[model samples]
Target: MSKLQEVFKNKSGNVLNVYCTAGYPHLESTLQIIDTLQKNGADIIELGMPYSDPLADGPVIQQSSLVALENGMTIATLFSQLKNLPSSTGDKEAAIILMGYMNPVLQYGFEKFCKDAAEVGVSGLILPDLPEYEYETEYGAIIKKCGLDFIFLVTPETSEERVRRLDLLSSGFLYAVSSSSTTGNEKDFNAVEKYLERLKSLNLKNPILVGFGIKDKETFNTACKYANGAIIGTAYIKALEGAANVEQATKKFLAGILK
Candidate 1:
């Protein structure tokens, strides 16, 4: 089983998966944020690669990405920042997943990106814009050969047949988009519940992690009750913007998850 699948097995027992954009708010803050999330009980961490044109991101994440890029965050710089993570995370074994568009990966070179990501401890990737057909036809085998789990995202609009196909293709967990929109939009619990029910009934091989608009404890609780875990982003970034230190910000942001 992939490390991500193993992490989900444990989280299925009881845990939350948290996602945060790398190099957001600042460059070095990425390392500190990952360390903080793991120390504070984030089961799985999604480190987003800041991109120039983030079509799927809401204003909060889009603006944060802009600021991150302005601070000179790039794939190479991100890899450099990640070199400090193993020591920083201490004994935590949280599965680290890189979330981004394909453009940056192409620019960084696919083989190099996969190889270096594995070396840096990234077990999986979430690319929103990469279609399933294209992935299967082209990049799927290469990513699998590199030992990377190419996580698939399914929205409210995704069909059951597609879900089954994705379940078969996905090596780790399925990222269930909470609603039919970008991050920071209000999560439609009704839509999320229906999707969760469908996914559970399908009995796919992998577990599911709900993302987008999972801002606080209530939403997190709702997601975990229906799915394996919840992935939070925009709200956490907003908290970091008002924080004195990244650690403090992470502490405060996670405090809500527990409360």
Candidate 2:
């Protein structure tokens, strides 16, 4: 089984998947952040490949992406850095998943991207802009061939039928977007709970991880009550801003959520 699959099979709840912008804070800080996160409490790490037009990200993450780009972080550089993740991190506990826009991934060549990702010990991918029809027709086979899992996102507005369809296509956990808007926005927990409950009733094939507005312990715990876990992105990035120590910042951020 993939590392991500093992995580779910062994632990059924309170799964904390933290998202970080690769090459953010500094170009060479990718491995540092990943290592620190897993060592602290993160079960899965979603390393974002910074892109110019990150349609789904909020201002904080967008600014991080801008800085990362300015610092000269590309997919090639990210792969090279990830190549040393094992030796740098000490112990590889958390499953690493790449999150990025399709534009950059396509520019890097999709097949090569998947192969290199697998070679560097990446477990899965989260391409929000990749449509379901395109995946089934063109990219699904390539992803499966590389032994990489693909995660699909579903919002409260998604119909039950479509949600189940995505769950069937997805290999890892299904990302349940708390709202139909961009990341880092506030959400209505009452409405979010009803949505999560609705998703739970569907009996999806994959685990559900609620993202967007999941910034603290309360939100994390609240999300876990209905889904398998929660994904923290914007809050964590905001924490890293202007911080002197990335490792210490990551540890403190994760502790506040998982401890």
Candidate 3:
């Protein structure tokens, strides 16, 4: 099993996943932010690849992505940044997952990108635009060869058959988008609950990590009640912007979720 799978399995329920844009605020800040989140009890880290066009993202993430790109963040640069991560210490070993779209991977060459990501300790890749069929046909074998877990997202609109297919092929946990729209958009809890019920009815083998619009303790608790874990993105970034230090911001964010 991949490190991501192991981590989620160990944590079981109420896992806190954090997302950040690579090279945002500053290039060197990428590792620092991730390290901070880890120290503050983020179970899994979703490091945004900083693509030029993040279609599935809301304004907050889109703005962060643009800033990261302006700071010269690219696939190669992100790998380079990962290579410079600090040595592991204490009980703070967090799995890193690269989240982005497909164009950047194609631009970087799929095989080379996978190889580089593995070399730099990324546990997996989350491609929002990668259809299950296309991945199975083209890059699935290559991704497996590199020992990288490729995650797929399931939305309310996802069919029962598609959910099963995605679950069977998924190595890491499946990302469950809370709503049909982009990340960070708010929707009814009833809708989210219904979606969870639908996913449960499918009896998927892989664990699920809920994402989008999960900003505080209430939402996190809601997600934990059904899914294996919950991911917070825009809220964490908002915290990052408010605090003087990344560590301080991470602590505040984590405290809110854990409370």
Candidate 4:
């Protein structure tokens, strides 16, 4: 089984997936951030690849992407850094998933990108802009051939039929966007509970991981009640913005979510 599949199979609920931008805060902080997150409480690490234009991201993540780019982060640099990561690091290991747009991957050569990702222990990819039909027709075989999971996103407006279809296509987990807006929007759990209920009724094959607006323990717990876990991106980025220590900030932020 892939590392991502093993994570979900071993951990049933409240799986905290933390999103961090590669080369953010500083250039060379990528592996350190992942190590800290894994040691803290993050069950999955979604590493954001800096992009010029990120449509699904909010201001916080957009700024992070900009800073990461400014720090000289590129697909090549990220792959090299990941490849250099230690082969074994005790038992505290979080499954890694690269989250970014398709343009960079295309620029980096899709097949080569997937091959490099797998070679470096990356378990999945989350391309927000990769449409389901296009992926199935063009890149699905490539992703699967590289032994990588490709996660799909679903919004409240998504039709049941489409959600089911996406569930069929998605591996690892389905990212459930809490609202129609971009990431980091303020969340109202009561307003989102109904949507969560709708998704829970679908009985998707892949586990659902609610994202966007999940900031603290209250929101995390509420989301977990309906899905297998929750993803925190913007909030964590905010925490990392001016923190004196990235590791400490990560630990504290995850504590707030999993507490």
Compose the digit string of candidate 1's lDDT tens values, residues 86-118: 653356667888999999999898888888998
| Pairs of residues clashing in candidate 1 | none
Task: Return the number of clashes found in candidate 1.
Answer: 0
What is candidate 1's local distance difference test score?
A: 0.83
lDDT of 4: 0.92
CA shift of 107, model 1, Å: 1.1
Off by over 4 Å in 4: none
TM-score of 1: 0.95
TM-score, every prediction: 0.95, 0.97, 0.96, 0.98
RMSD of each: 1.5, 1.2, 1.3, 0.9
* Model 3 / residue 97 / CA error / Å: 0.3
Task: Write the residue-wise lDDT of candidate 2 on 139-222 in tens digits.
Answer: 999999999999999999999999989999998899999999899999676788989999999988999999999999999999
Q: What is the lDDT of candidate 2?
A: 0.93
Q: Global lDDT of each model?
A: 0.83, 0.93, 0.86, 0.92
> Where is the poorest 10-residue window by lDDT in model 1?
84-93
Prediction-by-prediction clash tally = 0, 0, 0, 0
Return the top candidate by TM-score.
Answer: 4
Per-residue lDDT of model 3, residues 29-142, tens digit only: 888788878887888899998887889999888988988898888889888888988768775778999999899999899999999999999999999898877888999999
